[model samples]
Target: MAFRCQRDSYAREFTTSVVACCPAELQTDAGGKKEVLRGFHVVLEDTLLFPEGGGQPDDRGTINDIPVLRVTRRGAQADHFTQTPLSPGSQVQVQVDWERRFDHMQQHSGQHLITAVADHLFGLKTTSWELGRLRSIIELDSPSVTAEQVAAIEQSVNEKIRNRLPVTVRELSLDDPEVEQVRGRGLPDDHAGPIRVITIEGVDSNMCCGTHVSNLSDLQVIKILGTEKGKKNKTNLMFLAGNRVLKWMERSHGTEKALTTLLKCGAEEHVEAVKKLQNSIKLLQKEEPSLLQFHSLTSTWISCLFPLSRKEGDSEFMNIIANEIGSEETLLLLTVGDEKGAGLFLLSGPAEAVETLGPRVAEILEGKGAGKKGRFQGKATKMSRRAEVQALLQDYVSTQSAEE
Candidate 1:
């Protein structure tokens, strides 16, 4: 049995009797917190609100002035989940959200047209699709779709729309031979009643259960945003239809105006200006390594003075020094920030010696750090005690030499 919405997509309001109403709990995100909402599952004798199915979402509507949060199909019945309960056998006025319903109709029917055109023009079969909030996507089985193919597909689709192709729906029994001719993945396991097939006159026919526009011209316009790489061996084609295209244009124009003001250039020069700015940034990054260099200490170990701002911490400079002068044969006791007061220190040397002496150095320097393998580092509040930390490391080196 077809629901009222499925039979007539334009139906906005209707009166129906509640066949059953049962308690249902819905978990919803309220102010970013997940909370369970108590509601009721209402089964109407006939409904104008479409239940969620296919690649489309459920329709928003009201039953007796109470909001219907969700609708789901169970077997052949459409279950309207609402916060307020209606009495069984009581007649209630139901009203569909026409704005939301019409937007969905445009996108749903638009998908059929695109899918058909893509399949006929190119052998790209739509494995799956999503009707996202702002845009819709059709995932094709191929790994990539070139710009040329997308342009041709878009052109052909719009041409058919201009031709004003009639979009019609028909129901056939499960055993009907015509069912074999309609394109579909296969019927759902719980599917009941006759199978529904949507056809665009002289274009293509597909077996789908979602509500759609009555004609191709009702789509207004379709804008193929671009293609994105999907899961391995799949390509997702993103697009906007009807009012969504206008919404996207409005947003894009606002962004363009903002960019023009920030860049001090016209829209035509924005790309070149951005490219030049990016190149300047890349050139600056190339000179960053010159910030540190190896200075020979009395023990022939490497030392470096950090001249960068305090906000730019010493970790990257210290790593660059360590990488340049391998720590196996020499020790690196590096300090950053003020020379006589608070600062940061890093002590890198032989693993065994560092593991044994790193913490003691941190203690003298009045900071904490952990070490693995051959590196120990931490902040130092008492950088005035740097002499003591140096003495400790020198003593360890002297003792090791004496033993050798």
Candidate 2:
């Protein structure tokens, strides 16, 4: 089953005879998740839709006005999955998603151009490429690529685009001697039959089965976004081509404008303003802990509850404050709070008071904690009810005095 997309990249729709219509089965994805899609896999004699392969996604469109969810390639045949099944021997109109197909063409061709330039200029070979949803990536067989090298490579690619180089397609036998002429990448071990060669005028010629634009001008433009370190010490270069680059530019300008307005500064002063604002916040946070306060509740009890910016190990700090407040016989309860209405409590001092009153306070505050003979610790919410702690200690003192 020869594919129509391979013969003519611009074929939007074609009436093809359905070879078979098989019922959908549970398909497992890369993550080992099974999904049962309600559709049938309609195999056509010839397909206009390209299947997912070669680091490119599948094309989506329609078959006889029914939405095509996915297209998959199996050996020599391509299957179009749709809800409405087409009868075998019947002819149905198959339409390819033109916008999606052309977008893929632009990025795929852009990748070849960049890959060729990278190899030619800096001896960096393209190990792999992926056509992502938002941007495309090419992994280069290099530990690192400098900024200057990226700028040069991007300049060369855009120059070729502006030159409007004619991109020609050639077919060669897999065993042909011309296979050695491929510059950047190697062929797959399982690849068979005739190899499709994509030639970028005088720039590059490589065996690629993915769709490409007829001319470099169709790419419109190419922009290298950034690079990251990938597996095996390779450099993955991120890029966008044609309309994607324009879309990114629009979004970037919009974000810059929003930032300038928010910071009350000019566009050029945004970085400075943000840095100053961060420093101011750090200064305020540093002064917050100095605002701590202590109060003596009764002869045998003390309360140390203060609102400060929350930090790690706050329980330990509160415990230290409790020990500072009174002797071993005295009852002490220390609490730390934040502006966001969160608090952690620490109780230490007399054995009887801590063992009995500790769990009582925890129950009243709706919190939990644990410690040894004369200490208990835990966290609680509702910092606004801080006054209730003082009243509890006062009542305990009054009861003790009355009993004596």
Candidate 3:
């Protein structure tokens, strides 16, 4: 058996390494101007940077005081893009941001755990995978899986995370028996070179090009957000892991607290209280027509007992209330509050007639509004001049009578 160099494949195992320096220069492209060249791109080197490939984002960090913006693969070689120019033949110390790296590892490993469980439990294969900022999505080869199945998969993956199964990375030739014995998805057969296989002991072994955590325990939890139908025979799944799950929980708890306070109820009573409040609102709405009698009586009493002079705001409110009372050919003018600002509405006739006069009324009110089928609906914010709105309404009524 011929031994190939394990340096590049094993770079992820080490936290630090040395990289070659290359010159960087600024250049313009189709989009516009940009800072192009700052650091040297290493042509051939053993580095821990996972280059952007296979639907995974590239790792980012500083290398020897120079910020490494991106890592990309050109054929079999990994290229590091940096912010500062590096001298030719200069040795640069590299440090991978372990937090970011480990996060990727957790997510990547969590993907394997869930995918393996899905395949074992439901015979559904993961066709594609994507790691996002807050969540990851996996496309399954099956058309649909029941909610129970998804829950089971989630539970199983969490169980595996608790088990802390060792994640082993092995390199082998395409024709090796060890590779053939693996029961998971294989990489493209036409590619020439060593094949990288990530094996989750006693669980799964799949050909992959992404870096992952060393143990399943590193993934604190795998929470499935949801699943939806994809293509004809595929389903897409969204999930969160580790710190992301914690963050989600924090936000959820905060929202619950706010809702509880706003609703004036305890956390446990919130759901029932909301249901009761909704029912009460519905019942009140049903009784609103009857309530109009009292409102009309009150308006008349206020008009007679107080002042005939109406504020624009009160006039607007009376008009709307009168319209809601199913009145037609009735004039409502009432004023409330001070002169600086007030609310007003002008309604005449039944719901239908009010609607017919809506456009003209809106013009008079200097406001925009819409009504159901045939009801006038509008409001005036400033009531400094209530007489203007009343005059407009009277003119609109006169125009309608003439048009008829």
Candidate 4:
């Protein structure tokens, strides 16, 4: 516990004896799902690697140049999962990735400062937090946090960081009287033995298991990007600290520059420019429907009077045809379909001929329809029957013409 509470954020290199090495231990798939990993897990006698716990990710490093693929804790043991197993009796040099470890320290410590300040200033409690790879998040108990409020909190957080307050780690016995007075959510239910708490001098103290920098100055800076609605009236604040803030700013500026060039406008004018472009597109779409039509061509069916077999059209097209062929002994069969699904069918001609053959043609085509006067229209699920229906219509017309 004393070694862990030391001020150093990085243990560059250390020699440790392997307590045990399992050739094959049943572990779960690393894909964050429930599946057997077949054989995985390594236990070292003593180590400085911090496994994934307390919302802070695991420390990734090398054990004698062999990559520590993953690290997870089972009870108090920090299991160093690796592909190359070191024998139990062998001693190997271990190295923790200081860059990654230090980043997490910044994020974890930044969260502590922000949470404490938020509670003190606005009465908003920190219910939960996440140390994300790209940016960290702190979930507040309030349902809403306005931009101005967040700005206020952000300003205070940086002010505390600029103060360069000392961050101290302490180990207190379970019976310690000061443990209850610590400003935090509370201790874990199963927590036992000495409690590990992080105290920011003159600011806040939190019961935490994650590593942190020795001073608030090590945080460099904390920037609150935005807020999102969380479960049960919670507002999650997205933020970045240390070098991450600079990297995020770099990326955002690059994107804005590109958008300005492409939109042919200043960064401040991008929104209005985009809105105008969208309105132009909407107007073009409104004009396209009237231009698409199924022009008619004559065929050998019925003097092509009503012109059988016209191109596909919508209900408006059918209306246009109906109005144009008024009171004429015209024969027109209209069919329309798209992407080869069900089709629409229409046959209009002399009242006697249409009334006589429309229903029969529909039955032959395996379609559903009704005829009134000299027009018939219906829906056909099996459009492949179009040819057969046409042939039957021609045959019926021939038979009727012969009798007449």
Sort the candidates on TM-score, descending order. 1, 2, 4, 3
Candidate topping lDDT: 1
Off by over 4 Å in 4: 2-7, 24-39, 189-192, 290-404
Candidates in order have lDDT scores of 0.84, 0.78, 0.66, 0.75
Q: Could you estimate the TM-score for every candidate?
A: 0.70, 0.69, 0.62, 0.67
Best by TM-score: 1
Q: Per-prediction RMSD in angstroms?
A: 14.3, 12.9, 13.5, 15.0
Q: Which stretches of candidate 2 lie over 4 Å from their true place?
A: 26-34, 183-192, 290-404
Candidate 4, run of 10 with poorest lDDT: 290-299
Candidate 1 vs candidate 4, TM-score winner: 1
Give the total clashing residue pairs for model 4.
0
Q: Any residue pairs clashing in model 1, and if so which?
A: none
Give lDDT tens digits, candidate 4, residues 15-109: 87888877554455556776644344778776667877678998888888888867876655667888777788889888888888889999999
Of the two candidates 1 and 3, the one with more favorable lDDT, higher being better, is 1
Candidate 1 lDDT tens digits, 1-404: 89999999999999999999999988888789998989999999999999999999999999999999999999999889898888999999999999999999999999999999999999999999999999999999999999999999999999988999999999999999999999998878999999999999999899999999999999988989999999989999999998899899999999999999987899999998787666545543553554233333324533222222232335545554455544554566766667567777777777887788889979998888888878888888887788777777777777777676
Indicate whether candidate 2 or candidate 3 has the larger TM-score.
2
Candidate 2's displacement at residue 363, Å, is: 58
